[model samples]
Target: MAFESFSEFLAMGTHGPYVWSVYGITGVFLVGMVLQTLSAKKKQLKRLHSILVKDVSEREK
Candidate 1:
């Protein structure tokens, strides 16, 4: 399945659209997952910080 030229490689023998679209969609999905994971971790850390502060304040009183 060797392409004789760059044009043929890009065309992917008429299956270019499907192959390129799949790659694009997969890239977007991976980026979205990474962002979601980062957001969740930030939220969890904020909540933990608040809880720790409250515990310390309670002990002082």
Candidate 2:
């Protein structure tokens, strides 16, 4: 199906709304998951670093 113009392509013969909505939702999910995973990793690393430092200080004492 050849679209006469860009707007026509977007309309997608009346299926555009559904198609575009699904794409938008999927994009949000992917971005949200990546951010959440990174945040969790950063927190874990910080906690581990503090624990290691405490252990080292105790050994010196």
Candidate 3:
């Protein structure tokens, strides 16, 4: 309602670049953080599994 058209809405009355850039940066960081968390979790699980396997094998001896 504030903007007359789609292009005008995107322009955001001369603040488009700054506003859109901030949004883009935030989205990138959010995605990066999610991916990093998943990767770290996978690595941690693998490490724990290895430690448990080693412990069990030692117990068998």
Candidate 4:
């Protein structure tokens, strides 16, 4: 498809909003998933560290 002018290209034949919104939502969802995974990993590591310390202390006594 070829546009006669720049404006026509941006309008995208009146489907611009729907097409752009899909892309935007996809990007946001990907970013959110990454952040959530990182925080969960941090929480898991902290919990594991405390559990290991407790086990070592019990064995000493």
Candidate 5:
């Protein structure tokens, strides 16, 4: 193996923190984007449902 031990692997010869930090930041942003998309979709569906219900009620009157 290129690394003698687990610590050595993590250190990645002094570049570990930079490389790992980038990976961490990327993961956080990706997760945030997914959550935001799901939230927006739910909000839109609720709004659409309310509009449809109002239209239907008006027609029945």
Candidate 6:
């Protein structure tokens, strides 16, 4: 509503590139962090499961 037209909104009065780039960088960083967390969690669970299985086998012997 503040912008007179769609072009003006995209332009953002000469600040469009900076604003959009910040948004893009933030989005990429957030996605990367989420992916990293998921991967780490999966690895941790797998390691724990293996440890538990080994312990159970040792106890059985």
lDDT of each: 0.96, 0.97, 0.99, 0.92, 0.98, 0.97
Task: Report each candidate's C-alpha RMSD, comma-separated, in the order given.
Answer: 2.6, 2.2, 2.1, 3.4, 2.1, 2.4
RMSD of 1: 2.6
Off by over 4 Å in 2: 57-61
lDDT by residue (31-56, candidate 1, tens digit) is 99999999999999999999999999
lDDT by residue (tens digit), candidate 3, 1-61 = 9999999999999999999999999999999999999999999999999999999999999
TM-score of 5: 0.70
TM-score of 4: 0.59
Model 5 per-residue lDDT at 59: 100
Model 4: how far residue 6 lies from native, Å? 7.4
- Report the C-alpha lDDT of model 6 over 1-61, residue by residue, as the tens digit: 7899999988999999998899999999999999999999999999999999999999999
**Residue-wise C-alpha lDDT for candidate 4, range 1-61, written one tens digit per residue:** 5889988877789998987789899999999999999999999999999999999999999
Alpha-carbon shift of residue 51 in model 5 (angstroms) = 2.4
Better of 1 and 5 by TM-score: 5
Q: Each model's TM-score?
A: 0.64, 0.71, 0.70, 0.59, 0.70, 0.65
Better of 2 and 5 by TM-score: 2
lDDT (C-alpha) at residue 16 in model 4: 82
Give candidate 1 regions above 4 Å deviation.
Answer: 1-9, 57-61
Cand. 1 Cα-lDDT? 0.96
Residue-wise C-alpha lDDT for candidate 5, range 1-61, written one tens digit per residue? 9999999999999999998999999999999999999999999999999999999999999
Ordered from best to worst lDDT, the candidate numbers read 3, 5, 6, 2, 1, 4
